[model samples]
Target: MLLPQALKKGDTIGIITPSSPAPVLFKARYERGLSQLERMGFKIKEGKCSKQTQSYRSASIQERSEEINDFIHDQEVRGIISTIGGMNSNSLLPYLDYAHLKKHPKVIMGYSDVTALLLGIYAKTGLTTFYGPAVVPSFGEYPEMLPKGKEYFEDVIQLRKKAPYVLDVPQEWTEEMLDWNTQDRQKQMVKNTGWKSLREGSATGKLIGGNLNTMSGFMSSAFFPDLEGVILFLEDSFKDIATQERSLSMLKISGVFDKIAGLIIGKHEHFNHLNAPFSIEDLLFEIMGETNIPILTNVDIGHTFPSHVFPIGIKVKLDANQGTIEFLENSVSE
Candidate 1:
C-alpha cells in the first residue's frame, strides 16, 4: 500500500461530503469542525458539493465523485476527510477516476458508510486509508473531538509512526451530548475502559475489513481486496446477531475467512440476536472454526466512541494474547 505523506501542521485538509450532506443537517457542528481544524493549525477546504442534498445521497453521484477527484488532484491539499458517512457511497465509485487518484494519493479518512470508499480506493490504487471518525462524529459535536479520536487521528497523520501499538481503553465513554454552543464544552473530558482481549494468540498480516454490511455489499464487486495474508477487522452497528452470522457465513462461503491470516473483531454496538435462539458468541465461534488463523474478538475499533485509527491497507502484527498490535512498517510517507 502506498503511504501518503504525513500531514504537517499547516497542510491543507479538504473536507468533502461524499455520501451524506452533513452541513445540511448539522450546520453548526460542521462549522465547529472547520473551526477546530483551523485552531489545530490546518487549513480547511470545503468541497463544492459539501452542502448539496439530494433524495438519498448528499449530492448527485457525478458531483460527489468530482469533488473527491478534485481534492485528490489538488496539489495543496495534503489529506482528505469525509464530513460523515451515509448509505449509497458506492454509487460514486464508477465516477471516481482511479488512475488519477493513483497518481496523486493522499490520506482519506472516514468510517461507517465511508468503508466502501476506503476499501475501493485501496483496491484500485493500493493506497492506505483510515477507517475512523468523521468531522461531525469526531470534531463537530457538543464537546470537541473525542479524546481517543483526536489521539488516534494525530497518531496516524502527525506522529508518522507504525503500529504494533498497544490499544488503550478510555477511562470513560459518553453517548450524551454536551452544549455545542458553549465554548467550555470543548474542554469537557470523556473517559474510557481501554481495550480487552477476547481470544488470546498472536498473528500478523495486512489489516483489512470494515463494516460487515459494507464489505458484504462489495463481495462480488471488482473493488474487493485480495484477502490473502490479511488480518480482517469486522464490525457493525444496529445489526442483529443473525444478520451478523449471515454476513460472516457469506464471507466464509466466499473463502474470505480461509484467505486471511488472522481475524480481529471490533466492537459491535446495538447487536442482538433475533429469535434464532443462538448467542453471538456461538455464531462467531462457529464461523471462525472454519479457519485456524488467530482470531481476536472485541478489539475496540468500530461503531463505538473513542476508537483507534489504524491504516486499513498496511501490515499489522496482532497479539490478541498480549492485547497488542505491532506494525512492521510505517503507515505514512516521510
Candidate 2:
C-alpha cells in the first residue's frame, strides 16, 4: 500500500460530499466540525458539492466524481476527508479516473458508505485510504469527538511509528440530545470497553475489510482485493444476525475466508436475530471453523460512535493473544 504524506499543522484538508449532501438541516454541526479541524491546526477547503443537494444524492454523480478527482490531483490539498458517508458512493465509482488518482495519491478518509470509494481506490490504485470518522459525525458532534477517536486521528495523520497498544472505548457512550450549536458541551468524556479476542492465537497479515453491506456490493467486482494473507476486518449496523450470516456465507463461497490469515470483527451494535436461534458468534465460529485463524471481535472500528481510524490496504499484525493490532509499515510518509 502506498502511504501518503502525513498532514502537517497547517496542511489544507479538503472536505467533499461524495455521497449524500451535507445534511441540510445540520449546517451548524457541519460548521462546528470544520471549526474543530481548524482548532486541531488544519486548514479546510470545501468541495463544490459540499452543500449541493439533488433528489437525495449529494450532487450529480459527475459533479461528485469531479470534485473528488479535483481534490486528489490538487497538489495544494494535503489530505481529503468526506463530510459524511451516505448511500450511493458506488455511483461515483464509474466516473472516477483511476489513472489520475493513482498518480496523485493522498489521504482519503471516511467509512460506512464511503467504504465503496475507499476500497475501490485501494484495489484499483493501491493507494491506502482510511476507514475513519467523517468531518460531520466525528468532528462536528455536539460533544466533539471521543478521546479515543481524537487519538486515533492524530496517530493516523501524524503517521506515528509506534502507536500505544491500547483499544480503550469511551465509558460514557451517549445518544442523548444536546445542542449542536454550542462548543460548551464539546469536552464531555465517555467510557469504553477495551478489546476482546474471539479465537485464542496470533496472526499477521495486511488489514482488509469494511462496512459489511457496502462490501457486499463489491463481492464479485474487481475492487475486492485478493484476500490472501489478510486479516479480514468486518462490521455492520442495522442488519440482523441472519443477514450478517448470509453475507458471511457470500464471503465464504467467494473463498474470502480460505485465503485470509486472520479475522477482526468490528462492532455490530444493532444486529438482531429473526427465527434463527444461533448468535452471531455461533454463526461466525461455524462458518470460519475450517480456517483455524485467530479471530477477534468488537474492536470498535466500524459503524459505531467513537471509532478508531484504520488504514485500509496496509500491512498489519494481529496478535490475538495480546488482543492488539500493530502496523507493519508506516501508514503515512514522513
User: Using alpha carbons, what is the TM-score of model 2?
Assistant: 0.91
Tens digits of per-residue lDDT for model 2, 195-295:
67888788877888888888876667887677889888898877897788888988888888889998998867566677687778889889766778888
**Ten contiguous residues with the weakest lDDT in model 1:** 180-189
Stretches of candidate 2 exceeding 4 Å from the true structure: 161-191, 274-276
Query: Candidate 1 — which residues are off by over 4 angstroms?
Result: 160-164, 175-196, 275-277
All candidates: CA RMSD (Å): 2.7, 2.7
Write candidate 1's Cα lDDT for 108-223 as tens digits. 98888889999998998999988877887677755466756778778777764454465555666644445544435544344554445666677878988888888766666888
Quote each prediction's TM-score.
Answer: 0.91, 0.91
